[model samples]
Target: MPFDFPLIATIAAVFLLAGFVKGVIGLGLPTISVGLLSLVMAPAQAAALLIVPSVITNLQQMRPTATLLPLARRLWSMMLGVILGTLAAGGLIAGANAAGAAAALGAALVLYAAIGLIQVRFQVAPRHEAWAAPVVGGLTGMVTAATGVFVLPAVPYLQAIGLEKDALVQALGLSFLVSTLALALTLSGAGVFTWASVLTLVPALAGQVVGQWLRTRIDAVTFRRWFFAGLLALGAFLALRWLLA
Candidate 1:
């Protein structure tokens, strides 16, 4: 499809804003970008637009957390499970169930954030870690492909694990990288990776990389507060949309 000037401009602007937010907070680029893009494009096109930018930002984030291998290793099972779940969901992710699932996911995020504020934490012993990681990973994978609900659950768990802020951010970037590759592969196999979509990655990644670079100058506390606030607002919006329907 040839690009529409107004639509491309809007997508670029929205992505720039999303990139800035993600750069500051280390996440939210995809959720924000996807949500915003849906207003202008089909859902699949929106997702396709996000793939390169998300991957680029994750690669950028991954560089700093290179030494967090131990933590990453520990979380491998869950990550793998997420990949499997995404693969399993396939095109089913585009159905009516997706909207309902997305709304539920939004509600879950609000609840999780609320519980975190209340200091009601899940105890993650070694045994629990073993079980929780894979289960969470699968859920994350399914949600990522479906509507990005996967990150909401995993983010809280990452915080609960006492992973350093940098470590958590890196893990998130890695998670996105892995899951996106899986999605791309699936799309490729299904004959949906058109040349135009592949070409769009260049500009998308350029914007995302710029955002990642801008992140280092932000204050940590301020970044996190804004990050969670954005997530909360997004969750509420999603829930309301569902309720109205």
Candidate 2:
């Protein structure tokens, strides 16, 4: 199903913006893309279009073959929970439920940005990973199944673990990479992802390239301050859409 010219253009523009944000911050491809595209398409369809690009960016983050092994070892149980949880929710994640998920995603975004703006730190104690990882990963997977957004508790949990900043980022990358892969599998099983949606990847990837180039020239810390601010606005819009509906 080739999209109309206008729809194609909109998809391109959405990804261009989303990719730039991701390059600056190392996340938000799914959040930004799904949030914006939901305005014009079904949440599931919007999610479908994100499949290829999300995986590509996460792969970039989780690079150096050696980097993945330790994280994967540490994260495997949580990652397993993510995959299983998504599969379990497969039946309920469409139609009206998808809208509800969007609303929930919106609310979470608003809260997430608020937390980021305040520069507060939350920690997960080392002994708790056994219990916490599965719980957090399960919740994250359920949200991904429903909303195509998966940051929430997982990010804060990862951030708080007292890993060096680099390791934390790597953990985020790995988490997102697995989430994307799990989402792709879940969406494939649901039979909602189509060839046309996959085609959207070309433009999205192109936008990411431009975003990566721009990222090097900018101050990431300063940009992130503004980024969270913009995220607040975006979240409000999404919340309003749900309210208006």
lDDT of 2: 0.79
- Alpha-carbon runs more than 4 Å astray in model 1: 64-68, 96-123, 189-191, 194-227, 242-245
Clash pairs for candidate 1: none
lDDT of 2 by residue, 1-245 (tens): 45389988898888888887777677878888888887777778888888888887777777766766887888888888887877777634464576676676678778878988998798888899898888888888887887888787778888887877677778888888888888888888788776665666677677778778888898888888887887788778878888898
Shift of residue 43 alpha carbon in model 1, Å: 2.4
Worst 10 residues of 1 by lDDT: 191-200
Q: Give the alpha-carbon lDDT of every model.
A: 0.67, 0.79
TM-score of each: 0.79, 0.91
Candidate 1, 135-239: lDDT as tens digits: 887877776666643465676666666666777777887777887776665555555444454445555566666766766766766666665666667667767
